[model samples]
Target: MEQSGGPRGPEGNEEARAAAHCYRHPDREANITCTRCERPICPECMISASVGFQCPECVKGGSGTGHAADANQPRTLAGGSLAADPRLVTKVLLGLNVAVFVAVMIQGDRLLDELLLFGQAATEPYGPVEGVAEGQWYRLLTSMFLHQEIWHILMNMLGLWFLGPPLEAALGRARFTGLYLLSGLAGSALTYLVAAPQQASLGASGAIFGLFGATAVLMRRMRYDMRPILVLLAINLLFTFTWSNISWEAHVGGLVAGAALAYALVHAPREKRTLVQYGAFGAMLLVVVVLCVVRTAQLTG
Candidate 1:
């Protein structure tokens, strides 16, 4: 006869312990099993459910019965998939900015001239012209990664380090990357639209401001305390208007674009989330292109 709740033999205990480990991460011990699949899952692999926690696969597949096979998969708060390393995109962006800064330091002003945002200008006194107006539109993007002053790069990189990880995790790599690039382009387009044709500007401030805007939106959406980000944004905006060297146009443009994009990404209906999120991205890109084109026409025609 067998006794219930009695001590087991060594082989039996070892098998029991092995069964307690998470199916997805064998090394992790799990006290809870997925409500849908009944498989052991660690906290990281658990997705909160109506009754209890479910595993990623169950959430991706549909309901506890797993009936809707073709339904959209589960995603992050902003319709993005969770990543193994959430900070990968942030690290890459930081690395690119740093690498461009180092290259500028080594190559001197020549590289800076090629990379910085300028609407229209002659390369040399009385020489042939070159700039965004002359079809050097790449400057809008390259300029976001270019910085000359040590203080400029330091400030921007510090902002990136602080604001980047959370947004990357929330938005995932692809959407976060799209937001950054589009925000930067929006900034460049605005600057080109309003600033003097011959004015030169270069820095990551535009993209950084965009991150600031998106962060505020994300915090509000998650119902997190918004005071801290709001205070920081206020301080930055104050500096933007007060500091003579700062490009206020870029800051403002990025902030608006980021806030709009983030809102669309996080608040879209679950049934149509992907379409709305990506559609917003395409719309933002279209706006940027239109701005650039109108500015180019103003300068060239």
Candidate 2:
């Protein structure tokens, strides 16, 4: 059965947080229309922030808020639970990551040794070794899918189970995939920049963090409160800072790149969405080029 709720003072804040995650304005009186989704935004949940009366979408796309909703309307996540369908891109990525992990484990020491090139051989002096290095260049993206350990993959995959579908549905197949790849590469780029010559890092935490970053962009764009994403980001960052072996550099880098990329791609007028997309795609390519050059110089120098 479909369930709905009225604004319960501060008690319903958790609901509000979840709504904000999906780009919905949840803290409001339930009557105002969101500037992006065109759904009714509430007064409590309305974001008249940097973008004015407009909702989150306007904020992301650089649109200003213009209209106000009547006081008589309602707000709800009660609209419906988002579908849980596995996105094609999400499934493919998960599958590839798991398959590679299993292959590495099965090959025992030899295979595992060979696959872990970047985490070991990649350096500021010699760069990655040839042959496998050529193949491993793709590791910038592939590494995001690869896991440092069994539990690492499990945790990331679980997070994907919750966050991936909604994001894919909102952005559609192609853009979703693009965001994941670019965000992962961004994480890799930072790892390359910040890590010591022998410092090694692996896993999809960076890309997963990118998904979190994109979620934040969507929330602001739809005019929802940024508190939820902000809070979540904070907690995770705190964990990153405290934990051992977690590449805080990759996490921060991936998140910044993801948010930047998502803003460039997701924020724009409907009329200009296409243009924004093309521009964002170009910009992402440029970032990759920059990373490649910097990596080469660092390795050769």
Candidate 3:
């Protein structure tokens, strides 16, 4: 008599096993099973554990002990928790810049006008007024990711790819992100304060220059050779002064902010490292805000 509901044949069993789906993502196939829970997990759901890969739930629950889940997690040099993907923040920032560049390319000058850093100006002559002085403060932050020219985005993204990952790895994601944004804000504030009120500026060059300064500080902190970065920075500064269309204010402002912030982040006393680092960030942000406030007064007065 034929077996009723018996075990599957070898090939059938293999096929059934191969068809297993991730518990978290039903649509996705999963081959690796979580060591802790024995749940099938896709790559995205896999978390490296002491013995083998674990699912997010298992990892979050720890090793069935009373200890904190991340108690044994590694820490970065700057006392931040080491991330599974050290360059994740860098990748996201680069992607944002590229995405903005693509959007600008498709939408043309209208999008650029809305995003660019400007003190006070209209999109066109006699058009509805815009710019930071007119309460369009978002421009200061948005302009950091905006780019018009292909070459401009290319250069900035290249700098980010090279410099960002190392900084992110060293300082950890949150601090690195803070450094980039505050530096960019510092640049925008300087440009608003000094440049012609109606003058327009947009680029990641400010943030890139900020990365340069941070890299120098990080290298020095690690006792690495200073000559290479110094030479590179010198060349960039020369170009900043000599290049006709370049905004020297943005470059200078970003460089100073990044250097100062990196110094505090890497050199803060270990006893109060977190407080000092965050305080430095707050101070930098305050400086940027103060500059914008003064400039706004001048423009609106």
- Which one wins on TM-score? 1
On residues 77-146, what C-alpha lDDT tens digit does candidate 2 reach at each position?
Answer: 2111122342766888778888878876777645543444252364335654442224356656656766
Clashing residue pairs in candidate 3 (N, C-alpha, C atoms within 3 angstroms): none
Expressed as tens digits, the lDDT of each residue in 34-146 for candidate 3 is 66556565544545443445565655656522234333553455666667787899999999999999998899988888899989987887898889999999999999999
Alpha-carbon runs more than 4 Å astray in model 3: 1-71
Q: What is the C-alpha lDDT of each candidate?
A: 0.80, 0.61, 0.80
How do the residues 1-301 of candidate 1 rate in per-residue lDDT, one tens digit apiece?
A: 1112323455544443456766667664556666665666654464544345566777765655433432244345565766778789999999999999999989998898899898999878998888999999899999999998999999999999998987886787798999998898899889988998889988988899999999999878755568999999999999999989889989999999989999998788767878998899999999988988999999889
Give me the displacement of residue 11 in model 2, in angstroms: 26
Global local distance difference test of model 2: 0.61
- Candidate 3: lDDT of 154? 90
Each prediction's number of clashing residue pairs: 0, 22, 0
After superposing candidate 2, which stretches have Cα over 4 Å from the reference?
1-86, 117-136
**Predicted structure 3: lDDT:** 0.80
